[model samples]
Target: MATMPSSEACSMALAMAAVEKGTGDDRGMETLQYSGWRCHRKIHARRPAGGMMPAVRRVPAHGSWQRTRGVMVASQFITQLAFTLGLPFLPLYLQQLGVHDPQRAALWAGASATFSGLAMALMAPIWGRLADRVGRKAMVLRATFAGVLVVGGMALVQGPVALLALRLLQGLLTGTVSASNTLVADSVPKNKLGSSMALMQTAVFAGAAGGPLIGGVIADRFGYRWPFGATAALLLLSGLLVLLGSREEFKPQARTQPSRSERRARTRQIWLLLGPIIVVNFLDQLAGSVVGPVLPLVIAHLAGGQQSGVATLTGTILGSVAVSASIGALIAGRLTGRWPPPQVVAACAGGAAVFALLQGLASSVLLLGVFRVIMGLFIGGTLPAANVLLGNLVPPQDRGVAFGLTASATSLGFAAGPLLGALLVHVGLRAPFLLTSGLLALECLWMVWSSRRLNSASG
Candidate 1:
């Protein structure tokens, strides 16, 4: 956690950290007692009495948090795998519904994804806020079980229009990633957060990397709708895993009644501090998703008349990109160590932009796959650099709100990108690819400008 730079940030930190890491264990409950809480200079550094990191007295909550981490990571993998199992085939599935034309199918596919993204964007903050009040585990259950219904219903949809409704509902009701992350964060101490977070992310990549390929094979052999049923079952299993394996003794924060003026002032402060970082997140997610809906159309086009195996082929390409992206994320730390994060972000965005353009020009599936896989490497770098900026830029106490806004931005971006791309599909399949390149180029230019501004200010 970054140090609080101002008295306001320090105060906010104190308010937010009250019931930090109180959870249940195998033998019994481990309660947090803030009775002897003090900021000892010997233990850390001398800070003001109400500075960040107020020491707390607590019973070591056994190894339950550790176990919780394990269970949650597994749950994350299963949940993500379940989601990707059917989502990536939306365009192909649209053809099965009634839209046989590739261009029209791509449009509906993008619409489906956009509707879902819009719902998630609208509801994310609401659900995130409620997770504090109602409980994170409850939110996770809400998301998981909701998916069991929404995705399962997708299997029964007879038309493209009906599918779009379910997609939107899926977004409004499900946010397993955000809910699970919140639960894991609340369940563990701050120091171990990095490892816990990394593990969770690894699970996401692992599941995503395999899900498309596996789901594709299933679709080819059985049918498109079969994967949807499989996804629902997997989601059920994921919910059960988290429900039975993990425990949360959640303690909600004491309600604060800040004045209207005070709340407005705080909102301004957050915007000033986090506005650029939030934009970066939004654009990053936007760039990543813009090509997703139309990739199957491109693959089918390149494959000529062999529509029979397009599902499997599409899945392979998507799975490969996911794997490459994961590897890129893993190596980003080393790259950041050698240069400033802004510079790293700029470099990677530039690379991604170049590769995205190459992808648009590729004549064959193999060439397109190569270009996308390479683009994924650069795509992966952007997130880690943005995260570094967040750590450096946002104060510890203020990060919760910062991250919450970022999540909203991400959802909006995800919703916007595909819709924008789908609109571009009217021009040509390659138009979306060209658009992805343009977005990444803009992202690169922004980072470069930001890097120069930071360097000049420091100099």
Candidate 2:
């Protein structure tokens, strides 16, 4: 799956833009100037009334925010790296946890993953709404600290049952990326929101692409348990960084709750954006998850059932996809710059659909990897496109909840994906890929139709 960008990147980009503008020398600041200009122009066009925040007001805040953003990006990168380090070995881990039978191990993996997704899906929205009230920084801190505890707890668990419980708890407590994104979205100038969001997305993909390769090496040399302990330590550091380094200027919504009619109207508006974006996010993840539980096994079967280096190979495959996705995200950011988000979204969804189907038809491991890499490139673009649209669609105050709701959709898809994958495996290993491709095709069609309706309405 593609990584969500941290809020830190947005803030960092904004601060750099501020610095570049003040200097006005154009000596070696093309990147900063481009980002700043992109954000400033877009935000100004959308919100002409706000004009620009005065330089005097923008400077001091930008300085503080920039430093915090730097720390946050570092911390988030480490956190993502740590979490994915051993995640590809979950089925193997389950086997070690006493599920000796291959089918049983697969089922347990799906169940554990499903429980975590279910728990996260249920809680994410509440936490998101809470962030709006308590502040996004607070929400992120909460997720990080809780992440340390739950992931660390995984190291101590001895059985599938215990591990499943810890995974479930992990979902409930850890949404650091989402919270951070919400905070960053709120902090940056509206005009630059798209660029800021794009940068954050790229940062996430970079970390995700690199983390698994290292994690695989570590897992092979050390053991599965070491990764969990290491993950906890990283989360603790991430939490400390956020608590000490990040700053936010959150303005709580009106104290009085909205009337029922107003609430209904707001909810309706939220769905207009949420409907397609959430569906896209869900479908994308569902497609990914369908293959997630059994990919290692599939690879092993393709490699003539070589069990010795399966973990490393699994990491290699997963890492390739992430690396390709990162490249795709960069391309998507540019595409969004030129075309409407919906058009970009349609293109990405369609590409992913075609590639996912090809993956199902692959007869060899090398071909599957090739299809996966190509699919990752397409899937990676979907989020940045959909995300920018969401950022534009939702009002500033509602972003935390909006992202939270997106997270919920993601969790629900993740929850269902493994279970579906497990079921498909019973039929045949390649079946999941076909199922995924079909789902993505339907999602693509719906998104195209919806975007056209939205465009026509707005026009």
Candidate 3:
């Protein structure tokens, strides 16, 4: 439960990372040339010296992809639900484990979450690279199964160190959202990439938005440990769903591997196109996570010190934000069809900033929840817009690593945000919300400053 982010989904590591479904040499090479409601892109990889397009073979969907997509969506929903079930309650659980002081519990929560994100940041690209070698389905299985062990172990932890260790293990082993997206993108047809990915994102959002509501009731009634058992069970079920339901037609492309120097050169070029996008991804995740670990603490404060029902209130508030976020993401995706992605991103970030400020100033949990819901709606758009901009600009060939790096950047933000939130909690419960607002404002400013440059460069 390490708060091991990016939402992992919000990383949009699948931002057309899915159109990778090629039979033979097409394996993961070509991205759907996504425009509005369209396919993906390809940063051409190792073009032949004879001036030929990198031989990309498009595999027809065979009409089975939609069925496959339905299963994948179910698996993703369950996976996200399992992750969120125990997440918002981590500090509460820590308090149960003897970190009784609210600030101390928040700090412990942040520390463990920071480590989990650090582990995930370090591992995301390695996993992404490995997925290229193995089948994407295998990576998806690995990620989901890893969750079974991690969450199951979390249930048995008796102290902070044990919890921290499990969280590190969670980061090292699990990245269900990212892995699942790659596999789905690999299995679904090119034409369906946008809809499939959007559905997948919605699954993540729905689970995140609703799971806490359920977890809150469970924890309030049964104690924090029960949610762990429940989460583990749900993860196991999700893993089984993916294991049995999804099919992978990916064939590792046969190609002479590029030398390290060549790979490095490609990475540098990818970074050039990706630098602005990466910053946006990082900020988007950071802005979201800053409030994540701190929210329950804020709720506890607003209620005049934690006594009872804090988990339920916290869950309600977090759930509201997530519900709004889902709507925001859909709206953002639609608006991208009409507006420049950067403009959409700037508008969303600006709106999120205003709401976040309002959230910081709220005196009651209901008002705080209301502001957070609005902020969620706006912040939710940031990722999809940024990802659209990325998918359109980064050559499809480089996008695998490009998206991996974005995941890494997102993970780094995930790692940093909670720690920042924890430190701000020392200032006051309101400080984290204010800091989150500033981050959103800065995110908006970054988009405003770079929108024209990014668009022009892509042109």
Q: Which ranges of candidate 2 are over 4 A from the true structure? A: 1-61, 255-258, 456-459
lDDT of 3 by residue, 320-383 (tens): 7778888887887777777788899999999998988898889998898888888888888888
Q: Please give each candidate's TM-score.
A: 0.82, 0.85, 0.85
**lDDT (CA) for every model shown?**
0.75, 0.75, 0.76
From the highest TM-score down, the ranking of the candidates is 3, 2, 1
True lDDT of residue 153, candidate 1: 95
lDDT of 3: 0.76
lDDT of 2 by residue, 205-313 (tens): 7777766777777778887777788888888988898888888766564444779976676567557647878888788778778888888888888889877878888
User: What's the TM for model 1?
Assistant: 0.82
lDDT of 1 by residue, 1-459 (tens): 222235455444444334423332222432332211121111212223554444333332759788888899899989988989888999888988999987788788888888898888888878877776677789889999999999999999999989999999998999887677667666665445444554665577678888999999999998899999999999999999989999877655444578997668766655654666677778888988888888787888888857878889888988888788767766664665556777877888899999999999999999999999899878876766665455445433233344556777888888998888888887888888888898889988887777754432212
**Separate clash counts for every candidate:** 0, 4, 12
